[model samples]
Target: MGRFITVEPGINIFVEDINPAGRKTIFFIHGWPLNHNQFEYQYDVLPAMGYRCVSMDWRGYGNSDKPITGYGFDRLADDLRIVVGALQLKDFTLAGHSTGGAIAIRYMARHQGFGVNKLVLIDAAAPSSVDKQTANEFITATLNDRPNMLHNLTNMFFFQLITGPFANWFMQMGLQAAGYATAAIMATLRDENVYSELQKIVVPTLIVHGVHDKIVPFAKGQETSKLIKGSQLVPFQYSGHGPFWEERERFNQLLIQFVG
Candidate 1:
């Protein structure tokens, strides 16, 4: 169900392809510093419901080869395009979370939404969501002390009370990534503006955001929805940055409803 795919000559991306026989397909992209493992909760349920869930650990994260370069949105989005072509994925629902959502925005514009029928943005960081100053501070923390930075990240990740062990597990995923890749992604979040990219999304789009999200505030979600014409915005009342985990059941239901 999982394998390493050669996205380029030397770069291989880890892909978790499940339930290949399912009627519908969902291609997932994880957020900053996380991997496909972040979608564990969704993967547990979606496949059983006749959904073919596919996720990849983009370069420098998870089981993927961590090259120092190609961390920018252009290269990242190109990697996605290559993967889609390699997988022969067509008419699939493209879903992205946080920074992944920003990359997804770039993909829509850069590749003309290639092979994508529907789009889903989960607590996406986009359209100038975070200012330059905060990004610089976060980059400083990531470079100087990644462990503590990830620890603090976990604290902001959820509104629900997660067990200590669960938090540790989440932090471990971030640790698996390369330090440069992690910091480079934050720099992308800082320097890149995806407002024009958002306007280019022409597919049926869904925006799911946590009302209490401190990382990428609820207002960004609201603003994102407005930018994408005809996009639907749904708020998770009891979630933080990670609505998919904090209010998982509701999140799963919303995904099912939206994808349907």
Candidate 2:
């Protein structure tokens, strides 16, 4: 079960601690349009491996308060700093997925005090201009009707493989529980350039990507791995954008080794 703590006014972050005695703290940041619950597999398994695992819903994405102003990478990084300070987390590992990866890089670049020792980027978007022409083509092709495209784009993270009544129920619950401020903030995040900040990170890093990922692609991960000194890249053969979800066991083992 997760415990709730107020990280800011009108915003309480939900966290679950599996083992307090663990030497290091692992903070998992979820990607866009998904809540902390997306990391349920990690939350369930990592604690037994002797690591204190903590995952929080980003502002507007999970149970946290979603305000219109707190969606940009800068604000999200600040919020992460606040939460780390609140918990007095030190010598911790920061792992982010997609947009969450961008936010983590920004936090490491700007904050000078936190002892973030390791970083893991899962199919993350690098801080470069996503081929504007390609983005436009994708938007045009996928969204024949702009209005309908908007709705689909909003829920693009959820895979169609998850079907039946449960999928419907899950989507309803996720949409209702997520904050409107999240959507507004997400719009601003789509404009961020995180590639420039990569060199500023001095910590040991790991870049994991799905070879078959259609969203972010393998080249982004390869480029990101090259930019960060001493960072290792792990590819999930049959996975797509969400390698952690698609290859949970392998992902967990790799993370454990990296954390050690």
Top candidate (TM-score): 1
Candidate 2, which segments miss by more than 4 Å at Cα?
A: 4-8, 129-179
Report lDDT (Cα) of residue 93, candidate 2: 92
Question: Candidate 2 overall Cα lDDT vs. reference?
Answer: 0.73
Model 2 agreement with the true structure over 227-252: per-residue lDDT tens digits: 88888999888677777766889999
lDDT of 1 by residue, 53-79 (tens): 999998999999999889888899999
Model 1 whole-model lDDT (C-alpha atoms): 0.92
Residue 259: error of model 2 in Å?
0.8
Candidate 2 displacement at residue 235 in angstroms: 0.9
Instruction: Give the clashing pairs for model 1.
Output: none
TM-score of 1: 0.98
